[model samples]
Target: MAECPVIEADELEKRLGNSIIVDCRYSLSDPEYGLRAYLSGHIPGAHFLDLEKDLSGPKGRHGGRHPLPPPEQFREVIERIGGTESSEYVAYDDDLTGASRFWFLCRYFGIRNVRVLNGGWEKWVREGRPVSTEVPSARRGHFQPHPAAGMVVDINWVRRMGRGYVLVDSRQRERYLGVHEAIDPKAGHIPGAVNIPYTAVTSGRGTLRPKEELEGVYRGLGGRPVVYCGSGVTACVNVLAMKLVGLDPLLYSGSWSDWVSYEDSPVATGEE
Candidate 1:
């Protein structure tokens, strides 16, 4: 059987000492909130990774709000976090959003042995697992980045192949429907894209639904669907969910943010 990409809090607790645990808690509304939360308490030995600083690159006119950083820079960040290529990485967040992003980034860069903490930090705290505020010392790591192709699709690729693939919008129903948009300039989703809010893949407790359930949810979407969201962050949740059910979906990293940047591109409002 294939290795599971999601690890429970108890499973993670046992592997904490050997694996490189990453605390990916973050707030889109308050960028510093994640760091504050991490400083207050985190899984011992886990390093904090910032979404804007560590995961994304500078926002250009076309690359959307949070473009991925250069591959070399990402590798450097991994090494700084004391992660070697061979290190078993386990990432988590209060919600699964940030944790999924970390998992996707590592996988997109071809780093295996990385998993997301199933049920996330809330479950850990609920279980009365140990937490710490002290930061860990940096250790030299030998992580050589080897980015894998086909895992991600840029804006150009989305425009070109979107018609041929099932373009899935992983944003909330409201966002997908253009009911309300708080961050981006425009509302609505890409033309012809179907909405499948990432939350549907998770249970009421915020943990992923069973594989059989996920398979049922993704049924008839066709194989190798392409997924995206407001920017490219929460979309990882959908991508991760698809992986949990043995499906490999491509990520439209630029997502709606990039799609709207082009004045000529079409946008659809309301349910399709």
Candidate 2:
């Protein structure tokens, strides 16, 4: 098997002192949830990084709900978190969503030594590993951002690409079918995207499925895929899952929200 982009909890425990462990626990419904959890207790030496403030940029007419911060801005964030280009980053959330977002962001900005913590915070706690409430002082880190081209595709590109690529909707089937939309002004999905909810990549325990299992799940998706979701957060979970199976997929960062922002863009409901 190829080297996966995930680091298991036990492996993380051994690397805690040397690596930068970021507690990326976040809730879309409650912005303060992650910080509160971090303050209450987190992995020893782990620093808290907020999703909205740190991970995303200002929302506007387009670019979806969670936009990527500018390269320099992201570089500053890396420095604030005491992360250098050479530092190994291990990001964790209660589930893989937030951590996967961090992982994708790091990769998009060309930070190569980043990985998501497999099974995340819940698994760490379940294992009864060490936890702490102490927040460490920021150490100045010399990190530079080199944003990778083609790592993320904008809405216009997605529009041009059309159904040529395997367009994957990483949201739940209901959201894809326009049954219920918790967020975004409109319901349904891009005209041709197929539903492949991010949850399929994980087991009931919230950890990712075995590599072979994940390969089987994505095997028939056909070639390199283009993955998207409500606002581009969970889509990275699919990207991570694909990488674990040795498949490289592109991300539609603007995703469905940006798609709906344009009134002329077509939307489809019901399963294909």
How high is the CA lDDT of each candidate model?
A: 0.87, 0.88
For residues 188-227, what per-residue lDDT tens digits would candidate 2 score against the true structure? 9998788899998899544899988888888787656999
> Candidate 2 — which residues are off by over 4 angstroms?
1-3, 162-164
Best by TM-score: 2
lDDT of 1: 0.87
lDDT of 1 at 43: 93
TM-score of each: 0.96, 0.97
TM-score of 2: 0.97
Clashes of 1: 0
- Tens digits of per-residue lDDT for model 1 on 124-232? 8889999998999877687888877778898788778834489999999999999999988999988878888999999954599888999999998864689999889
Clashing residue pairs found in predicted model 2: none
